[model samples]
Target: MNNWELLEIRESLLRDLAEFIEDNYYGTPAPHEYRRHELDVRLGKKLKFSSSYPQMTIRQRRASDLLLQVGLCGATEYALGTIEDEDQLKHGRERLVKMKGDLADLMRDYDNCLSEEERKLLLRQAKNNSNREESLKDSERDSLLKLVIGMAVGAYCYNPAALKNDAVSDITKDLEELGISISDDTVRKYLIQAAAKFPQARKA
Candidate 1:
């Protein structure tokens, strides 16, 4: 398949996995957090097999390939969406759990499979990826908070108690339009924090 076709396949797989996770494992206050942790451990193993040993059977190779794409898509989503740092850290830790197992299996199966330097390199790479993901998630949350507070401030300037009564309907609507899901409680928390931090900004 061409590059475009490959990309299409990958994107399709990621979308299906995301839908399955959300639909089956969605919670009221928090959706997909638990489900994603489970899936990451399960599918990350499949993805790693496909990535590390593409020469395995064709079916195994294909499955792993698709899973790796899904994992990358998930990491990218964490970067763009407002998933909390704790949630991201949880996911990262789950990934490390699988990685530890996979590394052990690799060493057992093949002596000198990865040299000492190479082993260190691989561990560093994995640790760096986890750190980067957590950082990106944090950045996404902070940016969303700033945006919510900025919008709330503008609204409060126009009409005091704009967010107090409705509590960020406009923010939620805007996020929905952007295909970003965030809890109302999170928005309200940011609103309160902003108001408290900048009490002077509030009009009499």
Candidate 2:
């Protein structure tokens, strides 16, 4: 059959499957015996059916789960001419390929559907949002740096050996206690910056 004919058939099958799930699972209750028999006939299996509500729900959910895979395989087969790939066709790789192709098609359609002015407006809004977020991050980083420098200066005033290894270890622990974790190396760097900023504090 032609690809168009195959797609049409698959669409009809999906519609019928959806209707079956809705009616039997979501519609008014049917006789358990009848439902069980119907399921057996449709599935071509002679398995037992449980009368409990939970068991019925499980079966219905299983039926619904098949809908997506069936649709994916149908679309993949139609687009790729066949669903038979030796290396890339097993274990849902084919579905992933189909999903990526569908996403590309959707993006293309979205671009085609929007006007040039609308696209430009969206781009401007995205850029503005990104810049605002970057500005906020810079402000936060500056505040944190100032706080660290002040702490480093205070430690230097309290102890003349503030930039030494033991002093840096103590500063690192203090920063951790204040919920600001800094490595010993970073603490030493901040201490050096603080000493440069406050030469009098280092001399005193």
Candidate 3:
């Protein structure tokens, strides 16, 4: 396949992974956060990379980043499941097995689309990125959890009083459905924090 076709396959895989995580793990990043736009002038430059022997285009870099995120989310789900719930743990393990196979196939196809030298360069870069991600896994996992909590808070911001009453259970239930195993007390804590930051939400 050509480079664009490979990119499309990567994009499709990323989307599938995101959907699976949102359905069975926790949540995925907001769609708008990943979309490229003409107004996003900085994104183009941020995604471009150059070297003396090999280079990565903006689209290729984006695919690589998406692949990394997909891997991170899958790993995080497995880690969370080990501590959170037995069902989740089982699901995490199954998903990871499938994901490994899918990723391996994608990498093979991606390598086929590149020259030998480019393949080596990309492999080296991917390894370095993976190593860096491993070092930051804890912080990244925390951030992901926080993002989910923040989303939960924002979802109920319009009805702050509900967060204190039966609404708190509703919020927790909703989060649980999204694969986020948050407690009512933790939900309340986040509500309070959100209220403190945006006092108007309390009035709402």
Judging by lDDT against the true structure, name the best candidate. Answer: 1
lDDT string, candidate 3, 1-204, tens digits:
332333444444344334222252223422111122111222223333334213554336554544653444334442542354677667777777776666566566545555677656545655665565457566665565456446555664435444124446676667667866654444555555554554444332
- Native-to-model Cα distance after best TM-score fit, residue 107 in candidate 2, in Å: 43
Candidate 1: misplaced stretches above 4 Å? 1-148, 156-163
- Predicted structure 2: lDDT: 0.44
The runs of at least 3 residues in candidate 3 whose Cα sits more than 4 Å from the true structure, single-residue gaps closed, are 1-83, 126-204
RMSD of 3: 15.6
Model 3: lowest-lDDT 10 consecutive positions? 30-39
Query: For residues 1-204, could you state the per-residue lDDT of candidate 2 as single tens digits?
Result: 232332332233334345344345422332222233234334322111333334433334333333333344433433332334655446456566666565445334434544688556656655665565457565665566566556655653434343223566576566667766554444555566555544555334
Candidate 2 wrong stretches, greater than 4 Å: 1-150, 155-165
TM-score of each: 0.29, 0.24, 0.29
Q: Model 1 Cα displacement at 184 (Å)?
A: 0.3
Cα deviation of 186, candidate 1, in Å: 0.6
Candidate 1 collision pairs? none
Considering summed lDDT, which 10 consecutive residues are worst modelled in model 2?
A: 44-53
- Candidate 3, pairs of clashing residues: none
